[model samples]
Target chain A: MISIIIMNKTAADIFDEYLAAKGLRQTNQRRQILDAFISVKSHCTIADLYDVLKKKDPSIGFATVHRNLRLLCEAGLAQEIKIGSGKARFELTFGQSHHDHLICLKCGKFIEVFDMQIERLQEKLAEANDFLPRKHKLEIYGYCRQCR
Target chain B: MISIIIMNKTAADIFDEYLAAKGLRQTNQRRQILDAFISVKSHCTIADLYDVLKKKDPSIGFATVHRNLRLLCEAGLAQEIKIGSGKARFELTFGQSHHDHLICLKCGKFIEVFDMQIERLQEKLAEANDFLPRKHKLEIYGYCRQCR
Candidate 1:
């Protein structure tokens, strides 16, 4: 629990540094959005984030939340996950290791997963094709245990 | 060369069946679009496909091309790949075995790749999480040899 708090603090520091580098202001609203985003443990759509923000501060408009989410993505503090035809979901990236997702089609659950073997093989596959690999996105979609 | 032609023909047949099942007319324009789409070996944006279609048939509008591409996705003949902040690219899916992609960030080139070990491990990971996996998408982005 203490580690999680430290992680969130580290994420906020990273975002602040990113904003400073871009000459962007660190507004109270942006801080609020980031806090709400970090508090949620699952991948969330913009609407999902907006809903949470709306409850806490009714004055915050949807568009502001949307723009801030994109800023967060640009800062590398968050990453967007697009699944099938669904709305793009943003998941926290800062202070997190590289991992893929197992998304539940029925309940919208996201299971973060990582495998050293899969990672090595991906690198090998890219190397075989003469590519200097940078990053990868792997998402497996299906029904979770209860949903199935 | 002969095998590629056979594959394109099978794709067209499958698309025709899909259009018929949806109670949609198999228009000449859509056929032309499909042909252009399948002929291109790399993943292409709508603008890329539109450029080819417009050169061949000036009457085909961009909206028609965009609509048809979405239809192709729904029909399982193509899949949309969103990489970074770039425009989404559509690649042919029909008459092809399951494979991932190695995308060149510099030149926008795509290399089709498959590995049995990665596939098996993905299934194992999903099963371990109690997920009934339906499908997966893995895209590795980097610089190809020439670009590097």
Candidate 2:
């Protein structure tokens, strides 16, 4: 819990820095959205995040949440993940190590996972193709243990 | 070239089977769209595919192209890939071995690659977490050799 709080603080600071770099103001609504996003700690669609935000402050409009989430992505504090043809989901990226996702097709649950061997092999594959790899996304779609 | 033609023929057969199973009539428009999709041989956005299609048959409307692409996906002959927050792109999946993508961030080129060892590791990872893994997508974004 302490670590998560620390990470959230850092995430806010990073967002502030990003805003400053882009000459964007640090608005109250953006802060609230960011706080709500960090608190969720799971893959959240725009609707999912808006529900959480609406509970705290009814004035927070859906468009506000939508736009701010895109800003957060541009700030490198969040990532947009698309599963199949569904609506996109946003997951916090700041202070998180590189990981893949195991998504439950039935329940829409996301299991963040990492494997060293897989990472190494990916690096080797990139080198073989002479690609200067930047990042990667791996999503395995199926049933989770509970669903199975 | 001959092999590609054979694979395309099989893809059309599979789509015909799928449509029959679903009680959907095989329309001439759907057949034209599928042929255009199979001939592209690269990741293409809806707009890209529509452009190729319009050149062959100028009467083909964008909405028709879009709807049939969705049908192609449902028929399991195509896959949709989303890179970042941009437009969705479709790729051929039939008659191909399981593979991942190396996408060039600069030129938007896609290199389909498969590594047996990486595939093995993914299976192990899914089993470790008690996941009943189905299909998986791995996309690495980078500067390709030419871009580099």
Candidate 3:
């Protein structure tokens, strides 16, 4: 199992570059969302991040949080995630920090893990199918140890 | 690339056992939904299936289609799928299916394909983490040949 490590360049750096190239403004609330997202230790929904950010900036709304996250994905600083609950979650990601998820169905808990072997096997499958793969998601769901 | 093969047992057979074991009635509408799903050649969302079913039975409601699809999932006759587009989609799944998706972002198309090597690698990852695996989803997204 690969340990979760912080990226050397933060989401702010990535977003700034993205905004500069795209000619987008980096608003204060957007910055706050980025900070809360960066500080989170695991995957979180928009509401989860908003609860934390709203305490600092009550003016922030759910739609604003949602829009910024969409931008973050376009900027390659975050990725959308789903774990069978029909709600979308977001997680910080880098070009090289790709991983899969182990979700706890009973407790709504998620664990991030990485495996080089799985990555290689996916490349082989895509090649065999003649499909040029850009991105992939693998989520394993079951009762966690504590829940079991 | 694996060829899509029809399952030996029909959805009605699988769902009948499921409904009988649960002491649930197999309604006529439920039967129609199952038929449309069985006839479908690829993954479909509730709206997509509902549209097709409505053409045959104008009385069929979206909620009814959604509910029956949920039951189909409980009976192991169908599997819910998504490819980073937020909306939930579903496909048929026998115990032996064990495939993943290659989604086309440009045209919103999804292709199902399987690989034994990918499955074995996932098992290895789960074992390494002491996770008792239950279910998993892998969706790779990019342009299809036509789109490219």
What's the count of clashing pairs in each model shown? Answer: 0, 0, 0
Candidate 3: misplaced stretches above 4 Å? Answer: A1-10, A94-96, B1-10, B94-96
**Deviation in Å, model 2, residue A146 alpha carbon:** 1.4
Model 3 local distance difference test score: 0.79
Give lDDT: candidate 3, residue B40: 69
TM-score of B-chain for each predicted structure, in order: 0.87, 0.88, 0.86
Q: Which scores better on lDDT, 1 or 3?
A: 1
Q: Rounded to one decimal, what is candidate 3's iRMSD?
A: 1.5
Q: What is the C-alpha DockQ of each candidate?
A: 0.72, 0.79, 0.63
Fnat, model 3, is 0.67
Q: Write the per-residue lDDT of candidate 2 for residues A48-125, one digit (tens) a residue.
A: 999998998998899999999999999988988877777888988877887899999999888989998899899999
TM-score ranking from best to worst?
Answer: 3, 2, 1
Which is the leading candidate under TM-score? 3
Model 3, residue A129: distance off in Å is 0.9
C-alpha positional error of residue A25 in candidate 1 after TM-score superposition, expressed in Å: 4.2
Q: Pick out the ten consecutive residues of candidate 1 chain A with the lowest summed lDDT.
A: A1-10
TM-score of 3: 0.86
Model 1 Cα shift for residue A62 (angstroms): 4.0
Q: For model 3, what is the error of residue B140's alpha carbon versus the real structure, in angstroms, after optimal superposition? A: 1.4
lDDT of 3 by residue, B1-148 (tens): 2223346654577788799999999888988888888776657889999999999999999999999999998998788775555667888775446778888878877777888877887777777777777878787877677776
